[model samples]
Target chain A: MLLQQIINGLTLGATYALIALGYTMVYGIIQLINFAHGDIYMIGAFIGVAAVALFHQNFFLTLATAMLACVVLGVTIERVAYRPLRRAPRLNLLITTIGVSIFLETFMTVLKGPQPTGFPTVLENVTLRVGTLEFSSIQLVILLVSVALMVGLQFIVKYTKIGKAMRAASEDYDTASLMGININRVISFTFAIGSALAAAGGVLVGIYFNSVSPYMGVTAGLKAFVAAVLGGIGNIPGAMLGGLLLGLAEVFGVAAGFSTYKDAIAFTLLIVILLVRPTGLLGRPIQRKV
Target chain B: MEQWLSSVIDPYYQQVLMLVGIYIIAALGLNLITGLCGQLTFGHAAFLSIGAYTAAILTRDFHLPFILSLVLGGLMAALFGILLGIPVLRLTGDYLGIATLGFGEIVRVAFTNMKITGGAIGLAAIPRASNLINVTFFVILAVAAVVLLENSRFGRALKAIREDEIAAEAMGINAMWYKIQAFGIGCFLAGISGGFYAHLLQYLNPNDFGFLKSFEILNFVVLGGLGSIPGTIVGTTVLTLAPEFLRFVQEYRMMIYGLLLVLMMIFRPHGLLGGVNFRRLLRRRKQKATALSS
Candidate 1:
């Protein structure tokens, strides 16, 4: 029973990690929280469903199509909504993101009514057993795909030349720009990558949960943000760890019959982690200038 | 003035005007924290809820007088504000915002589970104690209080802290104490506003005071101009009245807000600044032209 719960947690955790990555990366590069990122994930889910249900596409193709569409959307949001406020106060940028978030949610609501639509089941659900723990093929696929995307992200962020530029810009935006790094391109690239990952997570979650709605982004986005903060706001590895731990804790809390307070669990952990550690588990402690 | 306001305006607009007054109080409080003190919090609604519950319970169960109960409710919220501020005020910027958000969510969950608070079904039948007269009185009183507070020594200290905390500390200011006080004052206003909300609506539900409500208040402050009193009032009035003026406005309210935020931030980040204050601008421009000519 414990093993089954752990597996379930891991599957859930993987999707959270995908969305969390977008938050951490954006925060890392430009000190903005990218509040609209969650809605991007919601849009991705909608697209994934459209590809499968409307166009009758296969699973992998649907995922890719959703991801590609989101890449364009994310980059456009950055270029239009965020870039102009680049030199403005951090507060202005944050407000702009909130506006974008409200815009995207309401826009989607206008497009597709407020109700949640059933996700198309493109992949057949087959029971897969590993030892005594029984899980579905969909769970296995979600886990495998999430890990693969994360690994690919790590490779792109670490090994690529643009990744180098990304790191420099994250360290200091003005300094990186002064060094002829073309920080605009780097920031846009970062948004593109982050949005793609969130998009992938959205599709996987849609497939797992079998439903997608305009408002789904609000809760999942908040939890994923909590996971990002749990691991430390700007730390990539920390986001992954935080996502898994939050998922496990929530699953176990639900298992323990605190189902009514399920939403509270992530927030409680967030508050405790923020108050106690402030820096997160894998993050470097901030050096306060005396 | 109260009689004239009631007799002249239609019932629908009277309710709208009353809601606008309630929000003005809350937004002013939030403006102090976010705009003036530079401490951004997205959980101001949590304080509002605390006051609402306190007022509802006091008036309903204890059968206390409404005015006295309202003041007590405000005090109760201020107490929680200080408590929440002790640990949370240490963090700055976005981290502080998130922590406050967490606090808000915790408060909401607690309220939803408590029996005395009516669990999730909500508490109905508080005395219909609020009307235009009391709400207007409170609005004028709150505005005067904020203006006085801002022009005082404490207000300067808060401004200094907002500009640069370390510098404020270096100048013989007890930064932590002032921050806590500012946070307390902000919550007190939120509490008073919550009291008004409870009495005006005559019902209290935990879900009504969610993060979205907090965001709406924050938007009001930002859309007006952070730290500007007249600006915030103008911003709130404009936003609150937008839905009433246009057809199908309720449906597209959030959509327009989103668009307005983006366009405003990009083109005019300073918000209205109370729309240029034409007289003051004309005087300034005249002064500039004369000086140049001379």
Candidate 2:
């Protein structure tokens, strides 16, 4: 029973970690929270539902389409909402992001009619068992895909040319520009990649839960954001760790006979972590620019 | 025609006026924090909820007088705002935004789970004490207070901080104290607004005070320009009435609202009024002409 719950916790943690990666990476590079990222995630699920219903495709194809759609959406949001305000006050950019988020959420609510729809049964029904531990095959798939994505992200950030440019731009945009790197491209690419990851996470969640809704992203996005903060806002690896820890906390919080307190526990942990180590578990302490 | 006009238009106009008055009170409080202090709080709705709930409980359960309960509710919200602000005010910019967001969410969830808050079923049918007279009176009082604060020495200090915090501190301003004072005062106004909202709606629910409502209040501030009190009032009135005016676009109301916000940011990023005080603008123009002649 304990093992089953641990597996459940880990599965939940992996989804959060994936979403957290997107939020952390964007914040790390641009120092903007990308409030619209969650809405992009929601759009991805809606697109996934449409793809499956319209194309009559298999799960993998639908997932890919959803991710691709989200990448475009993410880039568009950045170009439209954020790029202009790049030179404006930080507060203006923050407000713009909120506007974009509200726009997307309300748009979806209006279009989708504020109701949740269940995903097709193909992915939802596939379950796998290993001895006494019974688990859905989709859960296993979600875990593997999330781990792979994180590993791939780590490699890209550490080794690739674009990754190197991303790091440079994050460290200092002006310096990166001086070094002949296109700051615009790097920022756009960061948003694109983060959005793609969010889309994938959204699809997985929709499949795992067998339901999708316009407002689902609000709570999930908030939790993932909290995870990002718990791990340290601008630290990628910290976001992953924080996501997992938050997931575990929620799962065990429910398992320990306080199901209703799950969200409260997650927030309490966030406050405690922030108070103890404002920089987070794997984050570098930011000194005041002064 | 005249008899019909009195019966039909008067009640609708009265309701609209009442709503505008209540929103003005709410937006004015937000202006103190976001406009003057330069703190972007995404949790003002939470404070409003606290005030509304407090007043509701006091009136319903404790049998307190309506006016006194309303004041008490505002006080409770201000107390919570101070408590939440103490640890988090040390952080600035986006960190502060996130911390406040979390605090807002915590308040929401707590309200959802608690039995006294009516647990998502919400609190209904207390009393509809916020008629046109009461709303109008409170609105005038709030406007006067905000206008007075804007012209006072303390208000100048707030503007100085908003212009540049480090510079203000260099000029011997007590930065932390001023920020806290602004936050506490903002909460007080937010509480009053919430109290009024409760009486107006005669229904209080946790769902009504979510992040979206916070964003709605924020929309008014941003659309009005940060520090302009009159602009805040105008912005709230226009935005609130826009949907009603465009009732044909009911299905796309939110989408249009979103587009309006985006366009406003792109075109008139300083807001419609751009923080210009009507009276001050006239004076400044006169002063400029005098200087030019001199």
Which regions of candidate 2 deviate over 4 angstroms? A53-57, A124-132, B1-9, B163-171, B282-294
B190-282 in candidate 2: lDDT tens per residue? 898898889888898898998778878877887888788878988899888877786798878777777777767777777778667857878
Name the weakest run of 10 consecutive residues (lDDT summed) in model 1 chain A: A281-290
Candidate 2 lDDT, A1-290, residue by residue in tens: 88888889888988888788888988887788777778888898888888887667578888889889999999998898788878765656666777788788889888888999887754655667788888888889889889988899999999999999998887887889999998899989998889888998998898889899988888888889889998887788888898888888899899888776676777777766666777677877767542
Query: Would you give me the overall lDDT of model 2?
Result: 0.83
The numbered model that scores best in lDDT is 1
* DockQ of candidate 2 compared with the true complex: 0.54
Q: Chain B TM-score for each model?
A: 0.90, 0.91
TM-score of chain A of 1: 0.98
Inter-residue clash pairs, candidate 2: none
Each candidate's interface RMSD (Å, one decimal) is 1.5, 2.1
Supply candidate 2's per-residue lDDT for A195: 89
Q: Residue B104 CA error for candidate 2 (Å)?
A: 0.7
Tell me how far the alpha carbon of residue B46 in candidate 1 is from the true structure, in angstroms, after superposition. Answer: 1.0
DockQ of each: 0.65, 0.54
